[model samples]
Target: MRTAWLAERRSRSPAAHKTMDKIVTLLAKELRIQPRQAQVTLELLDGGNTVPFIARYRKERTGSLDEEQIRQVEARAQYLRNLEKRRAEILQSVAGQGKLTPGLEQQLQQATKMQELEDLYLPYRPKKQTKARLARQKGLEPLAGCIVLQQDTKETPAALGAAFVDPGKDVPDAAAAWQGALWIVAEDIADEASLRALARKTLWDGARLTAELMTDERAGKDFLLYKEY
Candidate 1:
């Protein structure tokens, strides 16, 4: 509970959360509990006061959580604070772009992950070459929409797609028109908040951690340490 709470608090970030997670792992190792289970206890133990003070004064309640564990918890807590700070910066950047819609804002607030936020921001974030941008330059948005609504019971997709193909607008064919529309639909589905939430739930609950030694690099000779996340 403690570890998970801290992790949830830090989930919006990448670099900082990653550092914090490592510290949490160290704390867990010191305390002899799995990292998944230690985060909550570490959070609770570090909720208030200094490490020296906590170690000296609150030993009995924390299962004798020692100086090392206290240090690990404090380091993890500081990293989490940094993650929140960076998240604010990222949000401000996105907002400044004038592309932050209400739905996008809602997703940003509810996102449990930096990767998901990045993915959600991909459409709005500046990029040089994309199919939609090129298609729009060729003036294909309306034609695309026409094909997208082709499934309407009142009008056929092919008929609607055919009706809007302005040769002057560079709409090459019904296929090209619908292809652009399909791109939009795919991005919308990928960035949907509900879809993201379900996927995140699966990642948190279904994923398992694995690790291996760093034998080929700088630590090849060191029996002292080798680890993976």
Candidate 2:
């Protein structure tokens, strides 16, 4: 039984390898340990060993990591496993919709965090009746694609937008069509994983917080220290 399990594990798919590599990297960075230690500890955990048992009896396997460290590893490993499971479900969902492209599949395969995977899948996920969906319903997707491509810089937006005016679709004029196209473009930008990640990193690296009292009446209360900016 153990031999077959080992053989099956050795034949893990590429997606599993990617997930494991990300988990190992995260564990090493978060625990301040080597990747080999993280990998060994994860393997032991996956082999049905309890944290206490592994920390006490399997010290040599985990480089003498204590119970606390083993617990942390177990928690992080479970979270990563959940993340990978979500990724697989998302991939299967997207593929079932017949909308999964190579680029999208690659992004899904490489996503280490749930947030990143969800961000990448946002555009593909089923959403309520949003402005972007309404705009697409009006047959403005081709115009939106043109705006994204930005190939015809010589043509003004109004001039390009004039071509998509279909009264039957409720697109009355160039301005309304342009506005709908802008909605699609905005949603596309918001759904871009790389851009969202960069924006989040920038905000965290440079953001500052300021607090102030709501009014003078509350100034003399227990929040006196927060009265001024």
In Å, residue 198's CA in model 1 sits off its true spot by 3.0
lDDT of 2 at 153: 73
lDDT digits (tens) for residues 30-133 of candidate 2: 88999999999988877778888898898988999999998999888888889989988999999999999998899888887889998888878988899988
Tell me the number of clashing residue pairs for each predicted model: 5, 0
- Residue 73 accuracy (lDDT) in model 1: 64
User: How good is model 2 by TM-score?
Assistant: 0.74
When summed lDDT is taken over every stretch of 10 residues in candidate 1, the lowest stretch is 220-229
Shift in Å, residue 114, candidate 2: 2.0
The runs of at least 3 residues in candidate 1 whose Cα sits more than 4 Å from the true structure, single-residue gaps closed, are 1-65, 101-112, 142-151, 197-229
Top TM-score prediction, candidate number:
2
TM-score per prediction, in order, is: 0.50, 0.74
Quantify all predictions' global Cα lDDT against the true fold.
0.64, 0.88
Q: How far is candidate 1 from the true structure (C-alpha RMSD, Å)?
A: 11.8
> Which one is best on lDDT?
2
lDDT of 2 at 199: 93
